[model samples]
Target chain A: MPPDTTTVAPQSVAPSGAPASGRPADDLRTLESGLDALQAVPSTEKGSVRRILEGVLPPVLLLAGLVAVWQLYVVIARPRPDLVPGPLDVLGALGTAWADGRLQLAVLTSLERGGVGFLIAVAIGTPLGLLLAEWRPLRLALGPLLSGLQVLPSVAWVPAAIIWFGLSDATVYFVVLMGAVPSIANGLVSGIDQVPPQLRRVGTVLGAGRIQLATLVVLPAALPGYFSGLKQGWAFSWRSLMAAEIIAMGGTIGFGLGSMLQQSRELADLGSVLATILLILGVGILVELAVFAPIERRLLRRRGLTPGGIR
Target chain B: MSAAPAVLPAIRITALGKRFGADGPLVLDDVTLSIQPGEFVCLLGASGCGKSTLLNIIAGLDAPSTGTVTVASGSAAVMFQDAALFPWLTAGRNVELALKLRGVPRDKRRGKALELLDVVNLADAASKRPHELSGGMRQRVALARSLAQDRKVLLMDEPFAALDAITRDLLHEELERVWRETGRTIVFVTHNVREAARLGQRVLLMSSRPGRIANEWRLADDGPRRIESPEVSRLSIEITEQLRREIRRNAA
Candidate 1:
């Protein structure tokens, strides 16, 4: 990668004309200047520790304030410990669960089920959505059903799923599939619908076959929508798995967060119940931050579509 | 290569007509023209003229309502007014997609894309996405992508219309150089009289409202034509006057 400065010459690549003829070799000059004007300088904005601190501080302070308020309410109300656990009691219960490794086991079990179920939903939903998008008659027939399924809460599927499969992993998976597939499929459909007509024409004129157009052009163009669908699908899958665990009890299925929540309720361990609720909320928040947010930010940044980048 | 057979017309439009729906008005009616190999022909008309429609049909993006259109050699590639470079792809990747579709080997595509970008004087910008580039740069990438198709005919639909005057002038020179180098048959559609005069060896003027070929001019002169040249300005003025008359006739 050495510069090889000794061999370099300062000559223009554009064709030169005789000075007497007077075309003046301005074409190359014009091109060079025009490019100099058009080529954007790469962004130099740096993410310093100060900026990171600024971003994190508000959320941290808000959570602390909420906890303080909750503790104050408990102190004033002085409810019986068994009836309503204070924040400290819930934390103590969480610490004990963590020490015994029950908390870890429940978290792992629930996350594994949610991950597998959401992946399956994506596998089925993406192509279904693409098919629905491309074919007019199919979209007309089935589009409304997909939207309706999204509106129906994931909990509603638990009874039907239990009846179909009889308190097994199959029942849990069925519930997850019913809950998630519609959202992913519908997101993809809307994504496909939003594809600019000009881009499609560009694909056609570039000699892409129908399949090529769909896979290469339309699919990549729809990434934003697909990612949004994936996020929603994950949310639904988690909700559906919890619903299945809560309703279809005494299963041979492993201990999950939902079952733990139900057990704590039945035993009337209010502190454990609060701890379980926190764990569920924590897992959802963790996935949103670690998995979805970074990918979405990168996608938008690469396209220069971030609102901050516009001006 | 020197012994290669005589070159044929690159594009032929015969008795072509186009309409939208069954009840829609005719957009183009009985238009016929032949463009020679390596020729630069400009299609010029007013706003409602079906010049863009004709280019679309020539590019095979839309079908003619009647009659036949033939391309003499390889397929025609088109450059639209907007750059239409996929926002998801980098500049080099945008050009490489066309090459990929044309069945270029995967390993060769990257180098070939860089080379094409160099032809448009954008080798340094290969990694930039469409949005990172300004209007002119994006259009340059679009042009490179069209060239990667390696077609005999290049159909441009007002490709420079969206650019500012300075950028448009620069592009005119760049395009002229490319046409000279590649010897591709170019049918450039534009409403700009000076642009048509500067670039085209022949200009075909069409009348609007059931667009039809109303006049033709052949600039078989001896030298390179610049847009600001007296000769080019004179020709543009002549064409503009005739174009105005056609519009008035339609209005009347």
Candidate 2:
């Protein structure tokens, strides 16, 4: 096709006082600012209070709605206290646990176990993912198997883990690793696969060695996928730890949120059961908010992938 | 340009041929060409002409199926039709990466990258990510990144093909200015006849399906040539006619 050389004059977009190419300095400055203004994103200048409210209000309303529904069900059905617990009953149980410091202790133990398990998963999975991504024969043989493992729920691994490691922390860790490694590895592989060929070409042409290219170019490109994998891995770790704690039935392992849940269920203390479930949910959300969300937001915002970008 | 110091041409290709596989038809065949040092050469051809393939071989990014390409400078940088700037990187950091690869020290890279960005009229945009920049601005950053290589030869495969007409025009002027300033040998592959007429000191028109150089135009005038100039328009027409004839022959 004949290249269209004439479409519209650039003069409209050119900066005011843009020179007609005689003075080099003037022309450059005009072009620079003009280009900037042309591509400028709208200022994300919402008031801080408004921004906070926008972020927090919906979730708060959703929680309130959920509590209202729970309360309504309690009032309507008049379920025995031994069965479904009302929101206030659950809250009272939570407050009692908090006063005794068991709530904090249980949460910390679960979080620590989840954190350690996830770290181990990352340490193992990252290299495995890189290897699978780079080596065709190995990938072809094992890629499908890894993906299959990811789909299999962490609870399924608990029986095997208990048999192998007994009623110890190792059993919990084993289950967590089994649940998480595949996900993290798969994430890395997909990310590596998606690194655009042109970007690699650009890196090669720019004189980056294979190691440098992989580290500087490919790794950064794959960050979104890696971060996603990490998030999923954390979820897996948390789920696996809970399953192990609930099933193992050992007193020495200490009271994690999962152990507390089992104790509440056995005693028919539905209020404590509901409170334990809420605590588990709350901890998961807290970790996501404090650890993962900020990093993800920063990554996306800096790359201009976020809605408003860094504001 | 800089007083032609060396006898060697910037690029030399001899009896070049390319095929996808053993049984595949030849994409390029028996192409021989020489590009002088500090010259602006445009390879102008239609779709399936192997212009990009030829450029790739010269760039050391792809191996030719037959014959050879020898670049005197050894090092060359390429700019693609897409800006292909690392979206994860800021505009300056993209250029800085090129400089860093070339072994520019920690402190020097930032200064050098800023200078290169300035040349592309993007100094103020150094901290902006690729996704934040307009297509034109992204391309200018890509250009700056290419320039950061400090290489004597640049291979561009339709670098401005995706830009709007006005942006392309403005870039053409900026590119011409940079070319004049740097004195680097440039091989720009484009389907645009007017673009070839406007920028290239010499234009090579290639035929497709076993691509070969069919015609050549050397702009003899010493005066500056704009894309809209009568001389450029006349040359563009001449070349377009020749290209049309090549396409028609294929149709027949």
Candidate 3:
């Protein structure tokens, strides 16, 4: 059994041996500062030059090796120039296209279509994703359908779009939307799903209303996933546009990289065909590195999600 | 300090009870209590005693199945065990978010946030992200954020339970100082007997199995207290014995 009295009488106002007021506070300050300094996260960021080299070197080396192999095959096989063009022939084709400004025009035309299509996809997909995420019954009904649409090749839509729109810009845009919208919407859905329940509770405790919660807490938290989705959406839009341009050629359609490749094929210009493929691949790689890569790196770095020594 | 006779209780609960689902087991039963303004009370119990459930009810995060809880101040702020700081915001901005939600003007928020961070002795760590700060610093930033809510009542659910002993001890001092400085009504829930005896003016021990308030102790002395002090240890030992008895009774 314990003592009957619940209250303990005051023994003393201040203990005889206790540390003085200002001293303990100062000591605590020192101790805490020491702990903070000791446990601080070490900056592992490499120099700018080193980081660039690390990112760019491996791909460059791989491309060089591929070119070497192509030259060796040309030397050994001795095939017809029009059938399997050598690396130099492809370079010459690129040079001719550049000198005549055809390369620039083709690249710009394709890029403009891709950019407009992706912007439209963002406008459509963001709301659709937010709606799907918010309404449970809608999500249950449409979630699987969205995922299925993402897997269905946007290229498969080319013939239907051509039949519907009759070889115009509208046909290209329809194909691009069909390809990009699902991925963007699905990305947002998963991002919203992955937000920690704890964060929602925090927002509520801090007096966030429904709109405030969605705009401030939920949307920002969903950004990383949404961004990746946008990247994938852009890729799909570009691919779908290329497919539309290649198949639905002639009749008020501007010539793009895809049409250029098709033209080279018709003329038996294998070198130009290979050159156009290289140009397409180059555009994809350039967008990924110049636009998407830097943004993703900054996002992950701000959240401390990146592993050490990689920045 | 004692509340004036004319002042109302900071919090009043009447016949509070809670259960999860339609046929779910009762988690809390008949938990009626009143806390005076500026009183520092500890809700001490074993794990699964539904202490957290009672706190949630008072905080208005969970609804009580069979009673009403009234807070005279009309609002309360809570500090959770995990700190729960957003990783994207810096420590200062985390506090500023609460202020912004409270309708503070944009131009004034930064100054107020820095002031709150200063209250927790974290003025210099305002720009550091949650991930950059140590565990103790994160909790301090959380404390600063909760304080920025500027409510008269503060509810804490084992806020220091996850931290190391040395840090927990230091935080106890910081909390006591803050409590004294701000004079807010605090209802702190914890399983640690010594922690209760050290920080609380009154310790309410709750029993398990449809949790109810089983015993209470009042330590009326006004002075600095240490967890390892003989007085604290003596009271902790007494509470532990009563707690063991409650457990044994539940087992039967």
Candidate 4:
């Protein structure tokens, strides 16, 4: 990323002009205050106008380009109407699904499964991460196993989960957990690892006990890492939920895009299958925009980790 | 900012010695010092002179290899170069955190934190996060947070080295004043001789490798002694001569 070259020259935040400046530390206090004033505000205002335009214009052009290419491809392929539904046709399917109420149900079911499983994964992963990162003996014994599990594909868990839980929501949840727990734990571990030692020493000098260390020092220090893990864990949950839905094949499962595709495949309706896949993609992007991106932006904003070093 | 008044000697380190490995170099060799209750003392030396190690010992953050360190009152808090402020905390909350750990009441903490920030002259930006602060601002907040310990001693390790010249100069004055007003003992370490001279009531100079106190000076009764002044230059030359001999001996 190009460093945001924006400048925001804030007059010192001390509206009182300066602290009682005659004393030694008081002058230091005034200077410190001035610097703090600079800190509390960010520099984004400088290039925000240009940035807003830059951000908006290019994505619009990219979408237009994508649509144009799709149109051209359709014109060239010219498949039979039932075989090749255009983007409009898939959108129409989306509309019908919504009108039929099944879309809401399908989405709700998938989300419920992903959400519950992801939460459980985080709960398990956080402590597991703490152990993996802090407890040398435990980490030594389990670290490799945890790492190996993350790389082990979610699909590999489906067969085992089917055998263990046998086709209910439990099966889907089990698969999701299996897929995500490792990543969550590992994310936390890495977060803990990245925290500078100096911060930890601060905790010690502050007389932090074990719980205090974890809550105040370790956890906060690992936040950016934890958030990143959560993002990845959610991805895993959604992906694993889809996999389990497709393969488990035994539930009175709702018409989630995953199941919808399975049904469409069984009936050999390629257009519906394409529509279902597109629906899933759209939902993922929408959730990312509405949920995760906002969170990431929020975390970044609080830290004034803005593009410009405002002060 | 050097107005922090001294009530008592905040810290006294006598014949303090440290040696890391059995067969290796001595880190701090027979160092003796006393920090007046509100004095700003900077330990000026290159990387391995045990400047930080000595501060660590005084802060009671690390045990000394030998000798005794006695503090007049509460534990000394350390301010690291990176601000070392908890990122999870808002700037106000970070200060409050120190109070909380020190057993300051919950209700009292917020008010006290504001007061401390006001003392540091950063009362307005309480809610800002560390990431929101610039490099210099973060260190200032770090200073505030350390001060929140209510301890009479504050040990800083090259805390302003990372900041720019303008910010560094401003902080030096800030530190000076904080020490004076709060009457807290401050033991700051920096490689910068001027900074040591600028802030310290007395600067303790050290030679490298097997670090030893090469020289010391009392800046009291001096009228804004410039680093280039005859007195400052004489001391620097003497210390540098000692440093040169040590380096050459090590090379040999």
**Docking class of predicted structure 2:** acceptable
Q: How does chain A of every candidate compare to the true chain A by TM-score?
A: 0.85, 0.87, 0.90, 0.80
Q: Which of 2 and 3 is the better model by DockQ? A: 2
How many steric overlaps does candidate 2 have? 0
Off by over 4 Å in 1: A1-31, A38-45, A48-54, A73-84, A307-311, B1-7
Write candidate 3's Cα lDDT for B110-209 as tens digits.
Answer: 9999999988888999998888888889999999999999999999999988877767777887898889889999999998888899999999999997
lDDT of 1 at B93: 99
After superposition, the stretches of candidate 4 with alpha carbons farther than 4 Å from their true spots are A1-42, A45-61, A75-77, A95-101, A252-255, A306-311, B1-10, B21-24, B32-40, B222-234
Tell me, by lDDT, which candidate is best.
Answer: 3
Model 2, residue A181: what's the lDDT?
Answer: 98
TM-score of chain B of 2: 0.96
Which candidate model has the greater TM-score, 2 or 4?
Answer: 2
Question: Could you tell which candidate, 3 or 4, scores higher by DockQ?
Answer: 3
Residue A262 of model 1 has an lDDT of 92
Error (Å) of candidate 1 at residue B70 is 1.0
lDDT of 1 by residue, B1-252 (tens): 467357667898899999999879999999999889989999999987899999989888789999889998757999999998999999999999999999999999999999999988889889988888888888989999999999989999999888776677667878987898898999999988778888899999999989999999999846566665667766776787788789888766
Q: Please compute DockQ, using alpha carbons, for every candidate against the native two-chain complex.
A: 0.33, 0.45, 0.40, 0.39
TM-score of the second chain for every model: 0.96, 0.96, 0.97, 0.87
Per-residue error (Å), model 3, residue A68: 2.2
The better candidate by lDDT, 2 or 4, is 2
Q: What share of the true interface contacts does each candidate keep?
A: 0.43, 0.51, 0.35, 0.52
